[model samples]
Target: MGKLLSVNLAVPEPNPAKSVGRTGINKRPVDGPVPVRAPGPKHGGLGSGLVGDQIFDVQSHGGDDQAVYAYAREDYDWWQAELGRELPGGLFGENITTVGVDVNGAAIGERWRIGPDVVLQATFGRIPCATFQYKMAEPHWVKRFTQAARPGTYLRIVEPGEIRAGDEVTVVQQPKVRVTIAEGFRALMLEPALLPRLLEVEELPEEDLAEIRKRIARSTRQRD
Candidate 1:
């Protein structure tokens, strides 16, 4: 169990005209704030540029938190390379910062009960794009970030409860599956053939089931 230190949220400081898609739009500082949106269930719900229930998608969440993927001090080096500069703050653009938890170890469809209000699910992994390279000003930033940090896991709002800073995140449901956030990310970025494993977890909520199922079907056809 990791101690949830802070849960920060803002309206996204400088909004972009268009969405970044796979890559992130704004290249915020390692500790700087970025924009967030409320994506419908269509675009993984919590993908980048989204907040609240949306921050839960690893592929969808953006900013510095993505640098660590999980809030850990060990991820400092990876984010520095991505920014091409020193990190002023330990973490940035992360709604929930915590200590002690191998975020990447959790299964893809794993669910975590943080406090009483929030339920976080390790849905998917993030795939870097040109936007990430551009933001870091390094052509090799994405590769470095992925190799070293593997980013972190995303959390969905299962029950839709209020989450505040300094909350204690407890593992209410840890999936038995061996699939991890990094594995899920690679599956999406490379083969797109493994997403079905998550849908079968049986821990996902009904509201999120159909949307995740739809993504899996699309990916399966692409691979086929």
Candidate 2:
């Protein structure tokens, strides 16, 4: 049931037409992380919120499987009707898509052991933002995504390996916490205070925990 179908990449080039004021390509490259330029931000040029991996993007979040099986084709169609355009394919800009995997239902902190080397962590859910709307050419895309609230997901590369299409993806750990992706999304929006507590649990993998901790501290100081 868990098979890797394909891998894609989108290296950001200077796109001057974006309305959100971001200068990056939507998607490019056939494999590997988007080639980010330096002399930008310390975290490269990745945008905040619904842009970079730690927040809104993923290690590898999309492909044919998700586009066909996981994504809400009807919702996308509705979006097309509402805005007269197609929504972006898959969530998190994943390179490799998985077949027979319910990406949305996969618990937070769940690890998928793909082959001997590559392991992906379902670290968090993607939080849409203004740039998403700009790319979609729809102003209310963020609200629409939030309302639907079942948008795919974000993943982290736990172990680096040569990954190709058609490799079986196996779930290594299903997180115990009852925190749904929707809950995480809502909490991130309404009550960011809960993030620390959620991240403090030992159940979260080390890298995922570290990311949550960084976000918690960053948000805390922003308020103070």
Candidate 3:
């Protein structure tokens, strides 16, 4: 069991990294409970699972699979020590900032019951983008973040409801899959050799599975 430290919402900001010239990466902790529900698919969907939150880049961000983003406070502490700066709770664009939760270690398809009603299932790990780098304003931030391999987890709303700060998070179900968020991130971004391992987790989005299969096929042909 873990605790929800804060429920953050996007504070839209202008950015050149995105085609829209704006981004919702600037997230801040909000007071009171926020409604959460599935935002359907990407692109023409609702954008964000949280009511007040926004996602400017619909093509690349937000959807049913990535309805909610969560990062562990422990990881923030680590980054703060490494960067020697104050890393806030929602600085990583996560909707939820959690304490005592192994967000990176969570297995794909793992379901968590949050507070009293909301149920969220881990889908994938966040991949760093130019928008994130621009927000950080640090040279090689994408590379550094990728190398660190603590990319946090993106979850889909299983049972929609309201969530607020200080809510309790309980892992109600954990799949038998061995692939974890950290392993998935490393495989998809850093090392191609581990890509095959991701296939064992059926809960991954269809598009992602297709990409993994395509990459595996390409690698096999090259080997032959």
Better of 1 and 3 by TM-score: 3
lDDT of each: 0.51, 0.50, 0.94
Clashing pairs in 2: 4-166, 9-28, 10-28, 60-94, 61-94, 62-94
TM-score of 3: 0.98
Query: Candidate 2: TM-score?
Result: 0.59
What would you estimate as the lDDT of candidate 3?
Answer: 0.94
State residue 118's C-alpha deviation in candidate 3, in Å: 0.4
Global Cα lDDT for candidate 2: 0.50
Q: What digit string (tens of lDDT, one per residue) describes model 3 on residues 1-224? A: 89999999999999999789999999999999999999999978998999999999888899999999999999999999999999999999999999989999999999999999999999999989999999999889999999999999999999999999999999999888868999998888889999999999979988678888998899899999
- From the highest lDDT down, the ranking of the candidates is 3, 1, 2
Residue 131 error, candidate 2, Å? 1.8
Give the per-residue Cα lDDT of candidate 2 at 118. Answer: 64
Which run of 10 residues does model 1 get worst, by summed lDDT?
21-30
- Using all chains and alpha carbons, the TM-scores for the candidates as numbered come to 0.59, 0.59, 0.98
